[model samples]
Target: MSHISTINPATETTLETYTLMSMQAATDKVEACHDAFLKWRLKTHDERANYLKRIADGLRDRAEDIALLMTKETGKLLQDGKMEVELCAQILEYTAKNGPSILADEERAHSAGSKKGWVTYSPIGVIYSIQPWNFPLYQPIRVLASNLMAGNGVILKHASICTGSGLLLQEICNDAGLPENLFQVLVIDHDISDKIIEHERVRAVTMTGSDTAGRHIGHVAAKALKKTVLELGSNDAFLVLEDADIELAVKTCVEGRLFNNGETCVSAKRFVITDKVYDAFKEAFVKQMQAIKMGSPENEETQLGPLSSKDQFETVSEQVSKSVEAGAKLLCGGNPTDQTGYYYPATVLENCLPGTPAYDDEIFGPVASLIRAKDDEDAMRIANDSRYGLGGGIFSQDEDKAFRLARDHFDTGMVRINSFGAADPNMPFGGVKDSGYGREHGGFGMKEFVNAKAIYLP
Candidate 1:
């Protein structure tokens, strides 16, 4: 237990072993990051932005190798790995291009518009980032790019499964001429992680994971009087209205459900269809789900890959089994293949009632939950029934109506109309309720941990 072994989930082979660092060593790294921040904060916003662009270039230069390492460690499709790397670079470039204005000091009117004043965003100290393994590069880059632009040092404690990805990220940043110790990666367990939050130097924390874990981290950081941003996962619902384009609905649902091997946080997990089009949507969705070929991540033609780990595989399988025991009906897949890897087939479950895992929980796999609604109104109601509000989607031939519905009715943070997506560097990311609070991306993340000081002159 003292050493963490990285495994290739597809082949179930150990790729490398990393020893957990002592508490003293971990704290030293944190202290060093704080030292780096002192000098980093002295740099102008434009100076930090230049560093961000250089880091973006470094990511592209090594995209192939980083993507391959990601695929070997997490069972993500190689092509998807390449896309993730590109997405991360795009985020950095976007931040660099827009950061100067976003973080710029602005003149203001004060004393009832009779005097001059200004507002400035000054950097805090080290910010700790705890990210998941699903999108190893994208997750950390989103946090690192914005914070570094805001002149704050960052320390990432990546998911244990993607430790190598985290270390490689640090090297890339350094190679781009980032100031020494501006970014560091920690290879430690949860016990040491808690202590890191309690460290006197780490100014704020950001984590993306389950609500259960979010609560624990929130409580720990709160006791220390530190601000934290939590992006807990969601069981997003994609609704098919009565007038929805049946063809569009089917295609979008299939792609949304199976993307990232169906382990995405904002990916569609529940399908709520209006009774009028329920039959047609269900038939087409099931046929497409069954047609997907599950195979090795290295295969170019493979549509589905293994889950991230054996424990994740067992968790999804058990959720399906218990959902059936609690009255859910299975439509296509309910069992694992005889393959050597931890591969689960594209699964569908209907008759999903309340109090069952299929209806109430976020199943982090390629399983889709179907629920019937009386009409479009009922479908909207069903979509908002869960405690999560990360993101959702609506499929309809009436684009205007769909836009209005998404803008006015959907209870989630982000909504897709007649289509599907993962993340956008230009849009605000994060969610509400148990899906966690606060926002990232766009211009919001640049100010999340910054000290917004107000200055006045009379």
Candidate 2:
């Protein structure tokens, strides 16, 4: 009978505790979800869509409570928590509205004659999702909403730190008329998680976490011959061309780096700027990063909150130190306060070298790395010089040129022009290389785990 403590990152206090589920219980729950999926899969697309709409409604109805719970569980701003709920609701509604068509059988013309062929998307059973703590609601909802709409049951093995948020979501879905066990939350350890992934009833697995974890899970699932969709680590490079608007680049880059307390996988971690505007952009960016207020997440005036956990704080702090030791100059905020909470000030690093963690690794905190590019060509080159490619952005006045660069040159899976955002329900998200594979959102998620059967008429 093991247990996990949910500690509030901002206060370093225990918020709640959850008992670990035994192996037998976990097995039973998987069986239950599989049973539910059999019934759920028999429902028509429109019938399933109704449940999704109600889930969206339920989220809106409990938005305030949900936001507060999320903020307490993960030290994100209250405003951001509320926004996460809204985003979850949007995902639900979007999936409900577009899922039917996206998963509908497509009619195709085959051969040289007028013979017709078709491809039908069929629902798979339970999809086991392993999500991280950042954006507790949005991360799980990103997968759950789309999968549910696709007529698959889901089992969530959320980050231990955000267990409460995970269970709350399950309660909301059930309250909204989701069939019992269609969405279940498993409070289990890594051992149980591995076992669950290998469970026969679990049709597919999806994960959002570090590259290391992604590799391990991908390997295990692969060994079991199970399909996986992994959205892993990233050191997203935001390029500022010489022709870029300094004001816009500075503002957007700061928001991109510090959003979600700088815990996002798609956050702008590296700033690759052309020499012509390097100094100007660096100065303005450092000023904004330095000015961020570090206080209670509940305070509207506070711009930066504590790291999600003490371990995260230590990781960011150590990375900054090693980078500085390896010749990276600390432009600002190298020291974290000896405070009660796991607070690390917004930091900016310059003279980032290739071998150092500051330049190579993803600094998952309020730290920004500035890289001076020889020119616009070099900026784009530097942006692609990484093993990871989750998301990146370009800041330039030339919208058409930026679009071409993003479409043709950016090596990442998702890109932004002149602005920054984690995700959009209407656009495909996920990445390549060490960032892992598969796409989510924009109706693409609806087809990830489903079978695309080819029906050919000769």
Candidate 3:
């Protein structure tokens, strides 16, 4: 059997290696997961909730070890790794607390006057999730927690870099009282993954990755007529309105751009500032970005860490160079540091044109793109001009106005007002346009892979 080596992105060293499951073995896993789903779906939501709560407890119990492992595997900051564990725990708890009602049958009105109608949510077979390396645990947990509560079995094909994290998570769930084979990790390559998607036992697919990956998965699943929920990449815009507070905007923007070493799908990437506050916001934002400390993710004092791998480092470096070549002004930090590891400094670029990567593409690293707008209306316009609409934010002193803009004008799946946050368990998260489709969390995910059967009684 072929083997896959796990590399520690921070140190560029091999951490562990696992033999890839053969295609036959992958098919066997699908059958096992489907069998588990048949039994698991018979359990009531409350019964399944117990397992979720225990899973949360298991996460907390192993939080330290899991966080450290993830930091070593993905190069996310140590603190961020811990927070990811907490977020995973919170997702489990949230689904446990709210899932019963979310999945409960709903009484419906019949088209004909005399009949009583109702709708029931029933679990399908296995759901295959393809997740990325960033936010390793939370990404899978976001899908698994809701599916488990909904009585569906889960299978994960995590990014190669985070295979260890995926295996460990499956182990934790099993140890926390999840039935064997209910959630399996497929340690296989893309070819085998594609075959698994076509397996009759695998009912649905969900993915959190780049736009290109999303397209490929969506196509493969579509060919099989399988349901897909993809949370793809985004160049989410953070609009600074004319009346925005410069200090608050600068601080929040800096935090948003550099969080997770600037490798988040929904983090604020494009800064569209109204001309009134453009110079002030840019000056302060660049200063804060420059002041960030870059070093090992293990260092608590380091605000920025290396990209997840050498490939990512090269991609970000190349994107910056191409953007600068395309006439974008490099305000600060356009170069990689001399330090070892896949390290890139906090970078700020201005005068980003429409065609360059800085303005149009998702720069998945510690680089900020600044765009000037004529006014508040123009800033809103600029924010909506992107092909991606995963999540965006508005920075203004007037909360009511910002809320209106987000609610009415922002064309994204999730919106933030004067703040920076990747996700919350209470909110529905996903994206629009090239960012892919379907929603997770806020009670929506529990129903995604379920069969919503409508019944009529006379």
Candidate 4:
């Protein structure tokens, strides 16, 4: 076993070291998981449910320690990390409560004199889940819990920055009495990810990462004839109509953009406001942006944490500078502080034009670009102009108009009317267009890792 060192992205500090599974080791683990699945899948639904429940209990029991570890590893606020731990437990419990039923066989009547038809859900062998660092625990657990409960062994390739969280998950599973290798975490270098994905024992791949990475993984999986589910990056739009509640819209916008220090893939990247309320919305939005507290994530009072890494901080900072050079006006917080960590204040940019870099790009930091819309038509046009159609929101007082805009105009997988785009355990979450394909939560998420087989008997 090779040793892997964990480094804190914030302070470039060494946190801990653990033995990592090599490519050969990961391949062996996948084969072991495949062999284990023969008996694991044969187990009764009640048994599977018990295992999931135990995993949830373990997560809940160690929530504090896990949360702190996640904070140190990913630089998220401790409170947010704690909430993520709780959410991960809830997801596992939800899967335990719902997975068996969702996978229950369905019977259907066939044509006259034909064989009866039926559909059943079955595990798709070993599934490779490539997760991001943003939601270290929640993202991986969301897939792991459901896949494991469905009797599919999972192979996780978590971001290098969050390896500690990944190991913690494996520990939780072990404590829950899950078989070794059933939910293996591969610690191989990033270069070897594609080789593991191509392994014969791996039947499918699920990834949540950059669009470029998604496309690359998607291509390899497609060539191998393997099923894939991808949750790519997004440049989501938050449209506020003329009749929208200005105060409410502004508050939600702030919360949406600044949430996770604006590191979320679903965070609203573009703000399209109607002329009627543009001034008011911009004023309130900028004021709230300025008021956000940015410091050490360990501090309970810190509203915004450092960017996950120096690369991210520099990326967003450069985008802000280039946007200003292209005539976009910086209302607040465009400069990076001289602080120790990668801390840039919540930024607001206005008068953004089409040719600017920030106009079409996804700014993955506490930077909000304001685009003025002449009316609802312009708002829709601006929202749909992007290549990305992930999660988007429309703020409008008129119910009919909001519904119409969301249903007819918005080009996204998940749309929110009168609310910023959010996800829940019960809702299906994914996106359209360049945002990549496939859903990741609720019943839809469970199906991503399984194979739906139809049976007919004559």
Off by over 4 Å in 2: 109-115, 456-458
- Model 4, C-alpha of 76: deviation from truth (Å): 0.6
User: What are the lDDT scores of the predictions, listed in order?
Assistant: 0.94, 0.92, 0.93, 0.86
What's the lDDT of the predicted structure labeled candidate 2?
0.92
- For every candidate, C-alpha RMSD to the true structure in Å: 0.8, 1.2, 1.0, 1.7
**lDDT (Cα, 0-100) at 258 in candidate 2:** 89
Candidate 3 stretches with Cα past 4 Å from truth are none
Which digits, one per residue and each the tens of the lDDT, describe model 1 over residues 1-458? Answer: 68999899999999999999989999999999999999999999889989999999999999999999998889999999999999999999999999999999999999999999999999999999989999989999999999999999999999999999999999999999999998999999999999999999999999999999899999999999999999998999999999999998999999999999999999899999999999999999999999999899988999999999999999999999999999999999988867788899999999999998999999999999999999999999999999999999999889999999999999888999989999999999988889998889987898999999999988
Candidate 4 clashing pairs, residues 3+ apart or interchain: none
Each model's total of backbone clashes? 0, 0, 0, 0
lDDT of candidate 3 over 388-424, digit per residue (tens) = 9999999999999999999999999988998999888
The alpha-carbon lDDT assigned to residue 105 of candidate 4 equals 82
Tens digit of per-residue lDDT, candidate 4, span 252-290: 999899888898989988999999999999988998889
lDDT of 1: 0.94
Could you give candidate 2's per-residue lDDT for residues 1-458 as a string of tens digits? 49999999889999998899999999899999999999999888888989989999999999999988888888999999989999989998898889888888899988875899999888889999999999899999999988887889999999999999999999998899899998999999998999999999999999999999999999999999999999999999999998999999999999999898998999999999999999999889999988898899988888888899989988999999999999999889979878899888999999999999988999999999999999989999999999999999999999998999999999999999999998899999999999999999998888899999889988
Per-residue error for 242 in candidate 3, Å, reads 0.6
Give the 10-residue window scoring lowest on summed lDDT in candidate 1: 333-342
Ranking under lDDT, best-scoring first?
A: 1, 3, 2, 4
